[model samples]
Target: MKTAIYEKAGKITVAEIEKPSLQAKDDVIIKVVRACVCGSDLWRYDENVPHEHGDANSGHEAIGIVEEVGEDITTLVPGDFVIVPFTHGCGHCDACRTGFDGTCDNHPGYQNFGNNYQSQYIRFHYGNWALVKVPGQPSDYSEGMIKSLLTLADVMPTGYHAARVADVKPGDKIVVIGDGAVGQCAVIAAKMRGASQIIMMSRHADRQQMALESGATAVVAERGEEGIAKVREILGGGADAALECVGTEASIDQALGVLHNGGRIGFVGVPHYSNHALGSTFSTNIIIGGGAASVTTYVKDFLLDAVLKGQINPGRVFTQTYSLDNIDQAYKDMANRKTIKAMVTVD
Candidate 1:
C-alpha cells in the first residue's frame, strides 16, 4: 500500500507502507476511496506544529467501504459504505456522552495502538468511534455523488458546528469570514440554520461567486476595518452572528469587529501562534466559542439527510481532483490557492 508520509519538516512523500488491519474488537478495516486535503493539514505540511510521532498517514478526512471488521463490530460489516470521522472517541466516554468526541480518552494514537511492524514508530488504529455507515442510496443521487460523503466526515459537520455555536437564528444577519471550502460550507450551514441575510467576506472573485451560490446574500471583498464596515453598512448595524473559518489573527478580528454588541461568534479555524485578543469583545458582550468540530456527534443522521435531500452540495467545493500518484500536485495547488479544495481518488 502506498501512503502519504510526512517525510520531514515541510516535506511529504508517497511511501509504500503496509496496510492497516483491525487490532481492536470495535475496529473495522476500510478501503479508502476518496480523501481531501484539509487546511489544517497545511499546518503539518508547513511544520507549524511538529508532526505526531507516528502520523505518516497524511490525512484525516476520508470515505470508504468496509473491507473487514473485528469480531465485536456488529453494527458494520464488509461492503458497508462509511465515512471516516476525523476525531476519535469511544462512544461511551464522558466527553463523548456529552457529544464532545474530539477529546475522547480512548482515541487511537501510537501510544494506544502500539507501533507498526514495518516502522517501529508508526501507529495506525481505528475504532467504532471513527466510522459511520451510510444507508441505502436515494433514487435521485448518483454513485459519484456518494463519494462526496467524505465531506460529512469533517467539513460538513464542522461548518454546521460553526453556525450552531454562534446561535444563528431565523431573520438574523450573519457574516462568514472565510471563503475556503469550510468557509463556503459555513455559508450553506448558516442559510440552513435560517439566517435571513448572510454576508461572505472574501477577496477572491471566484470564491466570492461561490459563496453567493452557496447561499450568501452578499459578498464583501475587503479585510480589516474596511471589511467590517462593509458588512455593517449592508446590515444597517452589525451582524447578529459571525462565523470565522479562517484561522488567522486578521480573520478573527474581522469576525469580532463586524458583530453587534450582543452578537455571537463561532470560530472553527485552527489557530496559529499569534494571540487573538478578546478584550474588545468583552465590552460588547459578544459570546465567542468554537474549536475542532465534534464531527462524530453530527455524522450519524443530520449530515446524511442534508446530502441526500439535495439541500446542499458541499462537494462542489472540490474544484480540482488528483490521482493518489499525483498527491504532491494536489498539495501544491491547494497551498498556492489555485484550487479551493483538492480531492484525491484512491481507486
Candidate 2:
C-alpha cells in the first residue's frame, strides 16, 4: 500500500508500506476512496519536531469502502461504503451517547482507530458507531457528490460544530474569523442555522468569493482592529455571535473583537492561543464554547440530508484535486495558500 508520511518540518512524502489488517474484533479494513489534506495537517508540516511516522497517525479525514469487517461488527459488512470521521468512539460511552463522540471516554487519545487515511487502505477501529454508511459504492456518485460526502467526514461537521457551540440563532448576526476550509464551512453552517447576516473575515479574493458563495453576507479583508471595525461597520455594531475557525492568538482576538458585549463565541481551531488571550472575555458577558467536533453526531443528526439533497455545496471548498501519487504537491499548495483546500482521489 502507498501511505503519506510526515518526515519533518516542510516535508511530507508518499511511501510504500504494508497494508493494514484487522487487529481487533471490532476493527474494519477500509479501501480508501477519497481523502484530503486538512489545515491541521499543514500545522504538522510546519512543526520542527521529528514526525511520528507510522499507520497509527496519518491524514485524518476520509471516506472509503469497507473491504473487510470484524467479527464483532454486525451493523456493517464488506462492500459498505462509509465516511470515516477523524475521531472514533464506543457507541455506548457517555460521551458518544451525548453527541461528543470526539471525546469518547473508552477511546481516549489516539487509541481508537489508526487514522492513516491518506493511503490506499487503512484500519478503522470502534466500527459499530464511528463509521457513517453511505448509500452505495464510490462509482454510484459523481466526482463532485463524492467530494461533498468526504467533507462530512470532518470539515463540514467541524464547521457546523462551531455554529452549534456558539448557539447561532435565526436572525442573529455572526462573524467567522478564519477563511480556511473550516471557516468557509462555518459560513454555510451559520446560514443553515438561519442567521440573517453572515460576515466572513478573509483577505484573499478567492476565499472571499467562496465565502460569499457559501453564504457569507459580507467579507472583511482587513486583520486586527481594522478588520473588527470593518465587520462592526457592516453589521452596524458588534455581531451576536462570532465563530473562531483559526486557532491563533491573532485570530482568537479578531473573533473576540467583533462581538457584542453579551455575544457568544464558538471556536473549532486547533488551539494554538494561550489562556491570557481568552481572559479578556470575562469582563464582558461573552460565552466561549467548542472543541474537537463530534463528527458522527452532526452527520447522522442533520448535515447528511442537506448534502444528499443538494441543499448545500460544501465541497466547493475543495479548490484543487490530486492523485495519491501527487499528494506531496497537494500539501505544498495548501501550505502555500495556492489552494483553499486540496482533495485526493484514491479510487
Candidate 3:
C-alpha cells in the first residue's frame, strides 16, 4: 500500500507502507475512496507546528467503503458507504454522554487519526462511533454529491459549529471572517439559520464567488483594516455576530473588530493567538465561544439531510481535485492560495 507522509515544511511524499487491517474487536477496515487536504494539515506542511523528519500517516478527512468490521461492531457492515469524521468518542464517557465528543476522555481522540487515509485503506479503531452511513447507497449519489458529503467529515460541521456557538438567529446580520472552505460553509450555515444578511470577508475572486454561491449576501474583498471597514460600512456598523474561520492572529482581530457591542462571536479556527489576543475581547462585551467542535456528536444529522436534498452544496469549495498519488500537488496548490479546498479522488 502507498500512503502520504509529512516530510518537512512545504513537502509531502507518497511512500510504500504496510496495508492496515483491523487490530481491535471494535475496529473496521475501510477502502478509502476520497480524501481531503485540510487547512490544519498545512500547519505541519508550513512548519507552523513541530515536524520531525519521519514517514508517518497524515490525513484526517476521508470517505470510504467498508471492507470488514470487527466482531464487536454491529452498526456497519461490508459494502456500506461511510464518511469518517476526524473525531470520535467512547459512548460511555461523561463527556460523550453529555455530547462533547471532541473532549472525550475515555476513548481515543480520533479513529484512524494516527494513520493517513490518502492510501487505499484505513482501519477505524472505533467503527461504530467513527463512521456515519450515507443516507443512500453510492448509486444514489453523483460524484459531486459524494464530494459534498465529504465536507461533513469536518469543515461543514465546523462552520455549523461556529454558527451554533454564536447563536446565529433568524434575521440576524452576520459576518464570516475568512474565505476558506470553512468560511464559505459558515456563510451557508448562517443562511440556514435564517440570517437575513451574511457578509463574507474575502480577498480572492474565486473564493468571493463561492461565498456568494454559499449564501453570503455581501462580499468584502479587502483584507486587514480595510476589510473590517468594508464590513462595518456595509452592515451600517458591525454585524450582529461574527464567525471566525481563519485561524490566525490577524483573523481573530478582524473577527472581533467587525462585531457589534454585545455581539456573539463563534471562533472555529484552530487557535493561533496569544493570551493577550484572547483577553482583548473582554473590553468589547462580545461573548466569545468555540474551539474544536464536537461535530461528531451534534452536526452529522443536521447536515446529512441538507447535503442529500440539495439545499446546501458545500462541495463547491472543493475547487480543485487530484489523484491520490498526486497528493503533494494538492497541498502545494492550497499553500499557494490557488485552491479553496483541495480534494483527492481515489480508485
Best by TM-score: 2
Off by over 4 Å in 3: 48-50, 53-55, 92-94, 108-115, 275-280
Query: At residue 82, what lDDT does model 2 achieve?
Result: 94
**Ten-residue stretch with the least lDDT total in model 1:** 115-124
What TM-scores do the predictions have?
0.89, 0.96, 0.93
Q: Write the per-residue lDDT of candidate 1 for residues 270-295, one digit (tens) a residue.
A: 76526656565678899998876767
Point to the candidate with the largest lDDT: 2
- TM-score ranking from best to worst? 2, 3, 1
Compared with the true structure, what per-residue lDDT tens digits does model 3 show for residues 1-347? 77888887777888777888888999888888889898888877877555665545577788888999999998888989898777766666887676666657766545335657777888876778757888556667887898898898888988988998899999999999978888988999999999999998877888888888878898888878898888889988888899999878888788888888899999988888874555666777899888666657655557888888889998888889999889999999998999889998877
Model 1 global lDDT (CA atoms, 0 to 1): 0.76
Model 3 vs. true fold: TM:
0.93
Global CA lDDT computed for model 2: 0.88
Give all candidates' CA lDDT scores.
0.76, 0.88, 0.82
In lDDT terms, how accurate is model 3? 0.82
Span of 10 residues, lowest total lDDT, candidate 3: 106-115
Worst 10 residues of 2 by lDDT: 49-58
